[model samples]
Target: MLRALRSVRSGLHATYLESYFISQCDKLSSKWLTRGLHSAPAEDVAEDAGVTAAVGARSGERPNKSNRNQEVRPFTSIPGPKPLPLLGNKLFFTTIGGYPMERYWESVQRIYEKYGPVVKVERFSGSLDMVIAFRPEDTRKMFQAEGIYPMRPGLGILTHYRSKRPQWFSSPGLVPGNGPEWRRLRSVIHPLLRREVINAYRPAQTEVANDLVRAIAASNQHNTKQDPSRHIISDTLSILFHYTLEAVGVVSLGMRLGCLASTSANCQAQSIIKANIEVLNVLGESMLQPPLYKLFPTRGYRRLSAAQDTICRQVDVEVARRREELALDPEGFTQRHPFLASLMNNPDLSSQDVFLLLIETLQGGIDATATTLGFCLYFLAGHPAVQDKLLKEVQHVQPEIHTLQGLPYLRAVVQETLRLRPSAAARSRVIQEDTIISGYCVPAGTFVVSPPNVACYDPQIFPGA
Candidate 1:
């Protein structure tokens, strides 16, 4: 019965392919008509099976007529790993933990070593297109492909409630989708992330950093100064979270989280942000297990929702307060460092758009900066010599992180860290159109990804791996 079904399907596919090919010929004919060109012979058309297959695939049709003498050519199917029924390859992926990508990295390399550079894997209902580029050149090809060989949809764990918070940092199009909005936001923020803009934040950052240091010192003072050895490793993430809130506070709303003082005070706002971020961590982790996430109604989700609501309400209040303050002194908008204020003053952007942008920036800034800085520390810790080199470089300018700006080695350290342990490591996008990679002709509308684990570790780029 299965054989019969296959046969019937094959026949249908062949018919579809023939119709698709005829349509392509029509298109070609239309183009040539303007030049007064005659139609090519039938044999000429028949010889172009690759072109026919491509056209058919584009039109959502298939050619199942004959496997014989046909150019399997590049990739008839996007290759991947095979999986067991129902469960797929979930078990295999889950068994290897602590940096999901690392395990996948190892598996991908092993598969490529055994088979070739590109292989296929079955991931639940999805088919994963895996590639192990052993050289920097191959890595460049993948990155250069960008929109073509883009990051995959983040694991389900990271996407929970992503849509719920339109005000979410991810809302600025940073969450993952490939679209005009994403492009727009990226353009606006990239310049701000440049060394000059980052340096602009140094005054504020140093204030915050000093506050953190002071807090630690005070804790030790309270403890009778008996060898206070808790390393002042700025939870780059937490600090970033604080810094972002404060930055947006001053720039957007003419307010400040007063996080420096708040950290010591453990105020309501500080607690709320911490709670929400923690909830994010929990939810993000939970997204890994589909069944478990589905079966259980965790307290973390409730806490997260509550935290978000609280934060949003607080933001609304802050906005209202700023409006009243601006009413008293109209020049405040121009005078203040608030980014949102400048944007608000702009005649172009709507108030709603400005508000949404502020929220996205604040939230995204909080987490992303910290995650990046944390990852940098992670690499630095692993490579003590690298850390030592960095420390020596910083010694000449100790306590002046801004001086490290544009320093080649410092920049390399940061870039290398991002390459190795990206904060938002994996990403996903729907294939916009039919595309080819490593000889695989993938159909449009399919979800595709370039896992950083694989991209960063590509032997061609990093070599030693």
Candidate 2:
């Protein structure tokens, strides 16, 4: 039967194949659907062979042509590990307590190696069903199937946290949200993230970058060793984080955060940065671990809540400051910081919304940018030829704030680095409706993940792969 379907699939066009697959799936599962027999354990369903075979001894119903073809098959038929009863593959994640959770990427790679391009993993004892795809075609299917409002099933813990603080955030931000609220929030901030708006902040970004270089020079001078190689910034990631936070803060809040300052004068700014880092760490753990934090006020959850408060308080102060400045001298404020002023002018955005938006932008932008920069540095360090080529291009361009655009090779290096080690390694989407992928039926509300780390290595799509 599967062989005949494959033969027909080869001859049919793409659009026709979709309809044909759906029809086949319906025909295959019709008996179980008609008999209301879809609630059995997947293992039992697989072992039963057919409805008649499972119950025929008692009911004396003989296997007919229509009923025989419509027996519901186990989800395990779709190429994955043998799920353990109701727990499914959830135990796979919790095994050894922290080993699998800490090295999740490696674990995922192992699954991909064993199961090929497509695999299913259930979470929370079959409460959540996820289909992970490593092939480009499946990735495209997942994305193309997203209708007008694409739904991303983000961390629910964060959503619950936000819900508790109505005064701070009237609604959840883009990350832990979906549907109309997500759409409305996205549209409100869309203009601020546009090309022209980002380009307008080039001057500010250059200023922050220059300050960073100066700070690095100052720090290097303090090193007793004269050797260039030994004159390393003790914590390079911390320095980059400060640089990125300062840059993002300036662009988003229209204020210099003093993150690169050598002195401890900007205590509040430094505290906010620290809180942001803590928030990210705690949020990541909450996302991976079970929702035990929700039931019991765990230490990690308490820390997360405190960190969030610090971030929100700092952001609120900045927003209020900006609002007061706008009110005092609207014209001068608009001219000095047109982008932020425009956002402030929007009637649709409340002060809390603006504050959350700025916080989200700063939190997301800083760490991701810093991580990407680290990868680029690592790649350049390993590949001297590529580094030398990039150096020559930079020298030729003598890139100033505005002149950086002409260095094609430099841009290519960044692009290649992003392609090779994308900051966002995977993206998740909630299946909004029933869809078929690679001849497998995926029902609505299923969580689908596309791992670019795997797909980007496809030899068919990448010539040198």
Candidate 3:
């Protein structure tokens, strides 16, 4: 619901994260005017709603009275850093000491500045030819071209891994695949967005959060006894990771991971955290690199594979346990575990499908959500006045923060945080048909990368930027 929430220098774990953060609709003082919080004029809100609606539809643009041939420029006409020989634009990425994938959106932003709104990236080793579109109107139009199914074509490293291990990921599950199959798998998740569904998980979520606070208190209490000053110093991120993994475990796998319970650093939960981060980190790097892994198990591929294996094994074990229990009790199991139950009962899915899909939601979702929430807490920590207001509002909301009933500012804070420093920096989709972007004709099947960060940071789009 309102995730990516962190900032418990005192262990603001879980929705103990939930119990703390509050959403208020009142306009924050001049302090938040810069971030353009809830105080925005109605026109801006209306415009944003339009964009959100279009994006939500997830359908592509239809031909607007022969707009396809209305003097639209060729796809090659778009400007970007020039490619050279066989290496092509691979020079900008893949090479040692080249652009790191960790700051990929930065690279895209620079290209946006140098190449204007529509930038074409050509001839990267394993990547489809890409067009980086920056303008908002173009963004709206591009999504319109998405037609019935939006195709996002660049998870080469992941597709490669799952391809190798056909046993686990029979058809790449959902994350890296597209078309009818992807749409069907994705459909099963839509019901999860319902308020009733989220409400059902509230008690368990609260427990996980309380456990997070307990874990933090326990660790800091131990360290402080060793040295009174140790209380002042804490690996906040590490503790947050424990909470996030455990929280994710409750929702995704319908169980507590006991990450907070594990005192050992080499615990399975700790390993999953480590391996999960690596998978994301290296996957970003490999996406822009040469397709060496295609021919053989390159070092990056091997590393990704190993990390995936670690995550997959855990999922496999859980799936087997669930399956056995499911056999013994079907309806009871479904009532107890909504997430796993949905997957377990899907006629379209296999045991492997259940495991792989859980891997995405459990491990991958955990890393991104935790980091985002960490940023949110960091922002609140810097602005004490904002924190004070939030505390007052939080108390006002009392036990209803999850519904976000009275928490508009809290929602604004998250929105602004995501705009400023999002975990998923780049949003992309492969065009399913010929599309018009910034007056240029982008061919169907072209990889389109939209850097929302660039747009988010645009002074024109964001009032304060």
Q: Largest lDDT belongs to which candidate? A: 3
**TM-score rank order:** 3, 2, 1
Which lDDT values do the candidates have, in the order given?
A: 0.46, 0.62, 0.65
TM-score of each: 0.62, 0.78, 0.81
For candidate 3, lDDT tens digit of each residue in 254-295? 778888775356388888988988897787777666678999
- Comparing candidate 1 with candidate 3, which one achieves the higher lDDT? 3
Judging by lDDT, tell me the better candidate of 1 and 2: 2
RMSD (Cα, Å) of candidate 1? 16.9
Residue 21 Cα positional deviation in candidate 1, in Å, after optimal superposition? 55
lDDT of 2 at 286: 73
**TM-score of candidate 3 against the unseen true structure:** 0.81
**lDDT score of model 1?**
0.46
Worst 10 residues of 1 by lDDT: 6-15
